[model samples]
Target: MNKKGESKLTIVITVFAILIILVLSFLFYYYAVKSMSFSRSETASLSGYADNAGRKESAGLRTNVIIFKPSEVLPQQQKEGYCFSTSVADPFRQDAFRCQVENEIFDPCFTTEEQGIVFCQINPLAPEAFLIKLEKPLPKASLLEFTQDNWAWFVKLEDKTYCSPFTGTRPFFSQDQIAYYGCKSNNIEEQIVLIGDLMIDDIWTANKAVLIKEKDNWAIKFLEQIKIDSVWQ
Candidate 1:
């Protein structure tokens, strides 16, 4: 082969190799940036989730709860961590045995930030109705307030009255401004905000990371030591 032709072929091959390297580098950087952006978005979302969980736990007012001190946040971003999580991956799956109870409206949720215990009143209307005592010092007695006539207790959002049969939730659980769904014939699901962040410029400020991503059930579980009973008395 001619020396000139061989030199030209070598140059072409080198150029091709360089182009391939550049393309690969660009793609790698693009994906890396995308991953970073996703991480930030998730952090913000989880932060908000955690915040809502705190509020719900406070507003619940179920029973036997100690005051919770919010985690210390420095004036500057000195601390970066997740707080106030029940930490239960999924608490409402079948086979979840929970001791059921009834009580005054209370916040019975536990987060990792506070402790490893989750406490709350379990609605008896569930297929396997039982109280969920996730926190320490289980309920000594039961709060069975169900009746044959009423399947579940819920506050009516429309008229905000008919407090004749208060069963599960508080009548004035939240103000009129907050929107929620409730049914007279069943346990009204407040759809309470159990987790969240301070949304600032579409970015979460204070973060609460709830990593739960199950589609079928909730985060409340039954007690392993407890079972269902037709009569709570």
Candidate 2:
């Protein structure tokens, strides 16, 4: 009722309001961060990988990428017999990829595009080199064998075409083969929207994430590190 009492009451109310604001701000930030983390997946939608169930195929399987720079190596990159990584979680399984190795993986990146993907293309003869889903265990090759001629998939690594319909999971299938999967909207027959082979569209990642390049620049790169984070049934 007194002046001093009134002043004290106002101060307390002001302090309570400030506290509420601080609390609300913290809550807002916490929720925002949590949502973002959940949204983040350790996957990038690649050309063949897709979010649709019917589109799921061996093309979506996770593969490691390896890149060799021509400036770094003369000629091209060579592949030896192959090495298998033994870190696979299911040690008991006879078919485990635990033993890190290299081989059998024909094209590390999909040569075809999925339903909704965009891509950046490299010269089939891109001086820079790259590999997909590689393990350190791959056999070592001599420098003399490093030319485009020595590439394992050189048979299909030409720039003549960018994408084709996917028939099956033939590791050796070329972009032309991936064409079957597209339609009037996609028919090279329809628009022949042939840009530079540098841009790959309708990209999908192993985790079903779809993505498009922010720019039209093409660069070849191998995966940095491969860690077995989780297993799928």
Candidate 3:
């Protein structure tokens, strides 16, 4: 073939190769996002499924026992670096496990001015059903009291009953207006629970995030909503 024809052929080949690369890149990104979203939806649905399966033994009580795993956040004075590592003990099963918190997880929910501490209550039987206290109390007003079904408990937010049937008989305030509860009907293996900010937004929203561990790393659904912002606005 002549030099002109050969050069034209080379140019065509180069363009075709570039197009192939672009198409492959796009597909890879699309599938990765789709897989992450599916995982998050599955986790949220499982949480609901566990709740529905519970059988009530007595009035407002259940035969399925879901114990609260109580965890406390270290004080600001104790923060060593940008990341914090802590261990929690399961009160019922008497087992212990370690959880790590780094900039990727911490920066979303807390601000530089506010002290970021998490008191996590992880269940020994079902580690996924847990509670987190991630706020500093503000000076507001006095505590109020109310009674329902012959059970008396102090109300911190609004005078409303029934946070959850599993979160004890009474629902108490965590920080200011935050109310949290937990219910455990099933145990999930190889799951990572994240509590706090799930997105990088100016609005401070928190959620109870559940992620499944894939291989050595955790597969966080980058596109899907981790957990709804439980922060009461």
Each model's lDDT comes to: 0.32, 0.30, 0.33
Q: Candidate 2 on 61-161: residue-level lDDT in tens?
A: 43322232223222333323323332112222222222212434222222112211111113334444432333233332222322231112111112222
Q: Whose TM-score is greatest here?
A: 1
Off by over 4 Å in 1: 62-233
Q: Rank the candidates by TM-score, best first.
A: 1, 3, 2
lDDT of 3 by residue, 1-233 (tens): 99999999999999999999999999999999999999999988997777666533223331222223232432333232232221111111212222233332221112223244333222122233222233333222222243122111111111121112122232232233222323221346423222322232322222332344566544433222232212211
- Lowest lDDT 10-residue stretch of candidate 1: 224-233
All candidates' TM-scores?
0.27, 0.22, 0.25
41: Cα error in model 1, Å: 0.6
How far residue 110's Cα lies from its native spot in candidate 2, in Å, is 39
Report how far residue 180 has shifted in candidate 3, in Å: 39
Please give me the total number of clashing residue pairs in predicted model 2: 58
